[model samples]
Target: MRNPQRLNVPIQLDRDLPEPLHDQLAAQLRRAIARGQLAGRMPSTRTLAGVLGISRGVALAAYEVLLAEGRITGRHGSGTYVSGTGSAPVGAGSLPVRASDVVVDLRSDRPSTQAFPLAAWRAAWRRASHQAPPVEEPPPAGLPALRAAVAAYLRESRGLVLDGHEVVVTAGYADALALILRARHGAGRALIALEDPAPPALRHALARLGTVLPLPTDASGARPDLVPAGCDVVAVLPERGVLGARMPTERRRALAAWARESGGLVLEPAFDGLFNPSLTPRPSVLALGDADSTAMVGSFCDLLTPTLRLSFAVVPRRPAGAVEEGLHGQPSVTCQLAVADLLASGCVARRAERLSVLYGAKRAFVRQVLGAYPDTRLLGGDTGAAAALLLPAAVRAESVVGALLARRVRVADLAAFCHESGVRENGIAFSYGHLDAGLLSGALHALTGTLDDHRLPRRSAA
Candidate 1:
């Protein structure tokens, strides 16, 4: 921790500004501490109120915002201290996970449903139920409050800066992709480029468009330069993933630039809270480049649960027209408002940060257990609910999966994720999201034991 010291800087606040005074003060403080203008210890709320000639409530509120973001911490007896340096970029995006049940689900996409905020969700649902009835059908663009809330969630939690006008609510991820495809014009089968080895749902969505050529990727995520020439649309998860790799900030910029230069659209997940909040946030692709050609599409499946079908996309200049023209069917108003309440109040961000930390611990366990096995290579990138291990060339993935299933432990084959040939290599996926600590450890042991027996057939030998 930095040495505790007093804040020494001039804080300017304009009362006439449309933004709230507390918000203004919070913004200035956030920037100041991040840029080393005034950091370490800060004055008490009462002291700040007097010093700045503002109400005590305003000062307290400003501190609360920073505290929520983990940018500042208030010592019980001591003053507030800077907790962050603001050197990392804020990121937004999500990778959709596929789910099923087993004694131990090793599938790469399952979320920890146990951690689902049932209490908070119940409260939000009740609040939504009490809202005033809508006289007319909600707008296709989604409830205004929900849109604003989504924007705020992105800004606070994901680090992407956007507003309500940029967001369009949809049923979910596939719907967002379909809407984008329809939003396009003069399309004789919308030629599209998809990140290789993506979720089957994504592939299915693109199937409704035109031919989807696989955009090549390595352990570092998809390559923007390899996007097919003349493709009308490109979709990718800008956030990093386990074995799924991540598109770096530079790659994101290039991809965003590619969209602009090629006049194509870039579709990405709007909110993926799978990343560890303890680390520096990665910037969304849209955040790094002109959003006029890029769209960030996401849903609450990972954030809340898979049952809540609501989703949103930060629409670009072109697609914004189609979205407003009824490209989407608005979700139920009550649910929308309830979600709006959560996002607007920072509940979603707080919950996501907690879950990320929990999952990060589980991920580390998997690494520590299986990382040392022969021919087992843990995939790169520390964000995602799932973990991937590259198996020895001799171990057959299908056999391993079958063996695990027979033993009541289910896992996913990397081949299952590959749509076109050559999208991924031989590997197996393990998910700890839905699994408890004890189950996960047992599953790891079973996995290592399975790998120990050379009785399993090798590819060439098979």
Candidate 2:
């Protein structure tokens, strides 16, 4: 009667229960086996009794009950085997039902999925599918033609000087970052220093494999000095610093220096960098002749629709081969094909240009609405895509959020971006990218009314 070596149950039995220990153990084991935990194996009655500190007679009695119930079958020489009843049935649904459906979804980060260029995408996909040779092989680090097109697009539109060979297509910015991190530093020893108030998705991804050091950020952006000296990598949002403004050139140079000095890697996420119509495009850290120390990453999803999951990373010249090898080792071919189709079709580039103009107008409209409410203080002044509004200190952001939700107006609280525990100032971050003029106007009106009802003071005109 040896104990079942294969069985791994998570429950801890309570000896003080009024129910007999053997009955309790039997009931728990039955449920565990029924739930597929004790599949294909049976523990010996003697071993079970020894482990549970129960009498051998009690263990034999429990085994008799289980045997009668057809939970296990004893082979002649070998120990008992778990019967068919011991394992749970497969293919069961276990999803929860929602009580009330959400009407407005403002929490998403990308443009509406319905607005995706489906017709153009389908035509391009069909064209690619047909032209693609049967028994397809993975594209040379993503379709060569697409790479060339991206190179040309970046050079002309983004002020980046890149060759097709330098660009490697990725599923999205998140995937690109993961691949680059994996390549430069093996899955182990990859420590990424992230901004304290960073995108939750990116933070979660980095946290899964690497040590994450949360560096504090302010209006200027992530302070490079705060980054731990020994960190192997650093992730920075160049376009939208901590408070959502462009990181100054001086700070960029300092970060470059940090990477160079420490033999560290820098992942520069150029989010919404192309949308800035006012400022000259800042050179990417990877493109700053420090390709050995930095990787430039960007995504088309924000400019186009989220369905177009095309992103690219320009690795340092020396590490390009290692990065490509690491990428191929990982499973990401489907995403590469989809991105290639989108890029080759020229739909994403065209849509991005159109969206630039549309979002520009929307940004202007939001500004006008902010202007109407003289008390509101606009943070991240002249930022192209998203704007932050600071409400009076007296107004409760949670109350304002609830009121806006009641009016079917969706917006995000600035406090959600805070990393530390304390009473944060009242503010809201508004993205004009997906909003239309009417919706933007309505939301502004609701926000103004909410502020007025709370009797919050307005910022005085400078």
Candidate 3:
């Protein structure tokens, strides 16, 4: 056993100082622990009292107070020691196991089904199913009526006027992007410039096709003024995922100008725009510049349902041929016709409006819950169902995410979306889609408890 004097905690008790002896000792001990002076095994109550010239009961009372607060623990015949104070530095390996019996998931990427227009969608599908079955092959571009409806809806909603001929229906965003790249791939080697922190799957797809150069984006989702001079295609997300920020108008014009000057193509994926209905909608890059320079890609998976697997790209007259050459097969005629009816009957527009209102409220509530904790900031909840939470500097996002998962609250770390290394924002994206109030509250509580567990000071570096 260590000597009583070597206990090292400075305890100066003044009986005439009005404050009780035990309270004063406990306060000082708390300070010592906070300052890393007191750790591991502490001197026994008898030894501490003898060293400080205090009664044994007074020393015991002080130790009992610290024990009650979980600052110290006593093991039978082993003496008391500092407890509930983490001594190991936070890291990926030290994180909790990601399995639990509790059930609450906050992983970002889940879609909100609360506001789905089931009645309208069923009615549209019924109408499409009732139509006389045609034995003709699906058109190379898409069903004529569907293309026309998409064009009309785009004009009315996003202010992007395009002929039905410009619309090419595809399976989804991936299919649409692949078609664009194939059409834009001219004689020489194909090089593409993409924004950093983009969709991981899309980046992987681009890497498989050709060389991809990453362009950094600013706080508002605008790319830097300069890009590689020789790239044939420049793909941008108007509503960037993870970050949940949008590109500025001036930046949009710059991108269009680059595409026009370099004789390249700008593929703008307006996935978020599908559900986000604004009074003054932001015109797509296709509308901002000449049709030859830009193509707009959209997906129905954002609004209706992901399983529907319907998407389209609006291209210029010249590249319309490229889409035809690249596309292997057409989308399902029945699904296309159903969506067409939705667009033509204004059901899509009305549904988008209702979704905007419904999700807007849910997003606000989620932000409120996440914002209640100190040292946390929310990044993207503008147009998507997910929001990125910036954590405290000392906190590692993966560790917290893992901790939450161990308690059955699943969330994804933002670093998972990056293409390169050394990115250290320490954020996790939480998706509040389709989560009811009770589930959300429970998840938040679990997250809170996990964070609380990490509040103790970790072991210092060697």
Give the whole-model CA lDDT for all candidates, comma-separated. Answer: 0.70, 0.64, 0.70
Off by over 4 Å in 2: 1-102, 112-122, 163-165, 270-274, 318-321, 324-347, 372-376, 420-426, 458-462
Candidate 1 to truth, TM? 0.72
Taking the candidates one at a time, how many backbone clashes does each contain? 7, 1, 1
TM-score per candidate, chains pooled = 0.72, 0.68, 0.72
- Ranking by TM-score, best first? 1, 3, 2
Position 435, candidate 2: lDDT: 44
Task: Identify the superior model by TM-score, candidate 2 or candidate 3.
Answer: 3
lDDT of 2 by residue, 91-167 (tens): 24522112122223344455522234555765666665654454665553566666677777777665777542277
Deviation from native of the Cα of residue 183 in model 1, angstroms: 1.3
Q: Best by TM-score, which number?
A: 1
Q: Which stretches of candidate 1 lie over 4 Å from their true place?
A: 1-102, 163-165, 186-188, 318-321, 324-328, 455-462
Task: Give a tens-digit lDDT track for model 1, residues 78-175.
Answer: 66777732222222332211112225556646555433455577689899999688878788788888987887777776677763227778877777
- Estimate candidate 3's alpha-carbon lDDT, on a 0 to 1 scale: 0.70
Model 2 / residue 111 / CA error / Å: 2.6
